[model samples]
Target: MDTDRVRLCFYRLLQLFSTCAAFSLVASLGTGMGAVSHWSMFIWCFCFVITLITFIVQLGEYQPSLPFSGKSFLFTYACLATAFCLSASIMYAITYIQFLPHGPFRDQAAAAAAFSCIACVLYALEGAFLWLLFPETTFYFATIHGLFKLLETSVACIIFAFISNTSLHQHQPALVWCVAVYSICFTLGAVAMLLKLVKFESRLHTFFPHFLLGQTMLSVLLYASALVLWPLYQFNEEFGGQPQRSSDVSCSDELPSTLCIWDQKLTVAILTAINLLIHVADMAYWIHFIFIRSRASAITGL
Candidate 1:
């Protein structure tokens, strides 16, 4: 027990250090920020704050005082943190670090992105260690379906970040429908995750699995439509989109800062396809699980 406590404490401290270092590096960059920088900064600050609170809570062994299961809370937090940090690192690096002139600012930005990745890995490791340590502890999000839920939502979030204020869906009903599909599926997955975290899914018993399966099926259909419509509209010349990327000067500017609209469109399409695949896998798992469950029940009845 003492050894376990030491291990957890060391792990938490490492997470805290990485997050804090990332946030501080970003904060020290006093000027010339853009939308991506602001978003990355927000992620770093959020991670730092939450990690600090969690470290304190765990150190004090205050899990029993929380309204929800502490293990569930930690598991969920680690998963989300890993996703958020990875997204931040990727976005900040691609949008800022990759474009900045090789200098102190670029160095700092690169270091910050590196720290964010370190934090992401640490959080993922923490989640894995927790699972190995407490295999018996049940959290719906810890299941395969639940992990899919996390992936779907996380991917949707990155897609949203890429498209926000960019007007990638404007002036076309097809693109608008794609946006709607993303919103609906993201909401469904997010709400299901929230319910599980709050232990509300337990109240519904068998109904919860059906609910999950239904929503996953709905998401799969929605994403399939999005997968088809998004690329077709964005890449099809009939929709005023070029079949090939244009050589716009702004896209290749010396200080290419923000993501070009073309890049955003392509990214959204790719992420849409990826999320569609995840939802399909999620649907398949639930279907198989439900079928096996029913078969077992029928055998027991006989």
Candidate 2:
């Protein structure tokens, strides 16, 4: 198979894994499953950003834009690839601990853990692919992404464990802790992207647009999953025991646990369905794109 084709598959599959993980995360977060808050709250924000970028890229293809640059696209790709890998690894650990043969979400946790692992592998491959394509700068993106994610995931685990304690009253100033950590991570991700957005806009198409054609579709899936999670609550039962939302990860006086019940199992299901569709669409698009390009080159060579 062509390198492009392989990348197509890797990305689409990563989308599926990412989406399913998001679903479980959404449901888990919304309902505050197990000892942790739902994974959706903090994560959905990142997913939304990813979706927006994907949409912008899609629009750029049809309508052309001053922002189209090979360097920029490569940078965007690197940042996302970094996030995806980190999310996969952390999510795997979180779900594993959440279920742990001793928790109520065992089945869901197991499935999610598997997806996270696979997604992690794909992103690692993606990082490698990009390294080969642009060996000089891959390290910068990877390191930045890794540092951010390491902080995000590690803090999340600590925060989740802290909140999961049934004796929430003991963890004084819980609200402050959660808010501070989440704010820091959010700021880091945003600053990194803002810097990149500026860079992409400045540079022309130093990168081949065709290289990423049909590629941004998977991000759409993530966007869809993120959107659907906001109002869709099918897993309300899991919300009872969790700490109050300091909006998402911490407890506050404003929103009591009594009001935190939001089940998004249906949202998870929808994301899974979308993942299947993404996989199929990716396969179809890349095959067509590659074959057509190959044929054109063959004819042109004569």
Candidate 3:
């Protein structure tokens, strides 16, 4: 009815359409494309369902009945959808589209990738619109710390997807350790985000900040170890791993049906390094907050 609501509705509709189109394309392919296709399908379907539910809740004015703030829920979900859909698009393109021969399959995969990308952009726009149009609240994800937590979780999800093939980590104890590190950090990050979402942080004072600082420090150390170990175990010749991508048959061959172990290993290693950097940055922020900013605030009585 109002302009803001109207705009919101428009964005939701576009997101729904794009996600639907993307998934439909994937579904039409009938599962021949392998893990990437299934992963892409899951992302698209998840986004579509969540968007539909959020749209319905907003339209029906059911915010009061919900456990969380509806605006915060929508904004957070939009950010998540954008990250997931973007990853899905990229994964689908990298694993399938580039390898598929020129044919109907290739066209369908490309179309799905395009639609996924469109949906990702729409969700980003929706999140931005909500942020700009509404007054800022104390939503945890809106803060820099919260956003970094979300990024860490999202990147972990992508790494998980890439490493879904057991061949990359199977029989390799070091790579398994990297997976454990990812799991630990991802679990901690998700729990932190959920606590903030449920407003549990407000109930605690110094403990939560201290918890965050500890969590980040632990995450940094874990990821740093994983960053070095993953590449070392994956690329080192002495480890029975290929020294170059071209040396790996799956990666060197053209038009492979699925992503090669080399690619997955490299992707996991690269993402591990990126997440290591993110954790480092997060650690620095928490250290500064716990030591400098909080002390200054207490001293000034602000």
Candidate 4:
């Protein structure tokens, strides 16, 4: 078996594993019991284990090629491995802490804050990689994307801070405000990044249909899913309570609760569909990059 083929196979396997892990995490949210939600944890652990194994195998088998040194590749592998470990550990700790007998809201908020911080770090590293790989052309785009990610994560951090400080569990208005703001910012950033990608395309429009366009589609789907989930979570938080009406309530004074209109089942179904669509788009992008795009690049040496 050729080493290159083996490496490619491992890469594809890793991608599949990552896709499964993402889906598992989203699915776990729908489970009623928190303990039963550990399936997502197991999926994450499995991904890390496979990633380590793949790294070791590829390191031993592959020889250095031009454009980057073996040492640089090893450094990248180390950073990625460390980031994944940190993310998993923090997530597990947060989950475990959330189940404590006298757990405070701050504990849950801390977990989210920690996750957001780590995500920002990972995004920084990823942006650095893109800059290094495509210095002249990709640097500006990478910088813009990284800035947007930082802003997005910062919003999460702010929400976490508020959750930690305030009685967030009881503050329905605050929770709604946080979710709405976060969703809007995320959507706008995603759109900006997509536009950047579109503006960068040259003459390969017909061949690739713009790589960023597919990414934009995925981003829009994700944004829509987030919007749907935001209000649904708010509805869940407010359900079974005396319906709070705003100052603009009509003279009837018998208006139906907003929760009734927010339909959890429909929201969950739409989110799930969007998730599946994003996964499909991800697969298509990966296939196009690995096979068609790369092969064409090699042939044309462009």
Better of 1 and 3 by lDDT: 3
lDDT measured at residue 196 in model 3 versus the true structure, 0 to 100: 71
Tell me the whole-model lDDT of each prediction, alpha carbons only. Answer: 0.84, 0.43, 0.85, 0.41
Name model 2 segments beyond 4 Å from true: 1-6, 21-37, 40-105, 136-139, 142-178, 181-189, 200-302
Q: What are the C-alpha RMSDs, in order, of all predicted structures?
A: 2.5, 17.9, 2.1, 14.2
Question: Residue-wise lDDT of candidate 3 within 1-302, one digit each (tens)?
Answer: 89999999999999999999999998888766766568778889989998899899889988899777777788888888989999999888888788788999889889999999999999999888888878756556688997898789788988988776778888799889988999999998888877777777778876988988888899998998998888888899898777898888877666688788788888888888888888889988988888896788789996
Highest TM-score against the true fold, candidate? 3
Cα lDDT, model 1, residue 150: 83
Model 3 stretches astray by more than 4 angstroms: none
lDDT of 1 by residue, 1-302 (tens): 48876887787898888888988998898866666677788888888899889988888888888888888888898899999999999988887787777899889988989999999999999888888888899866677877898888788878877766446778789888988898999889888888888888779988988998999999999899988888888788887665676644446655566676678788888898898899999999999999999999999999
| Candidate 1 deviant stretches above 4 angstroms | 1-3, 30-34, 59-62, 139-141, 247-249, 252-255
lDDT by residue for model 2 over 94-199, one digit each (tens)? Answer: 4334434545555665555555555545555655666676666634345533343334333333334333433432333432333343334335434544544455
Better of 2 and 3 by lDDT: 3
Q: How far is 300's C-alpha from truth in model 1 (Å)?
A: 1.8
lDDT of 4 by residue, 152-196 (tens): 433332233223323323355534454454455445545544443
As a TM-score, model 4 comes out at: 0.33
Candidate 4 residue spans exceeding 4 A from truth = 1-40, 63-83, 101-209, 233-302
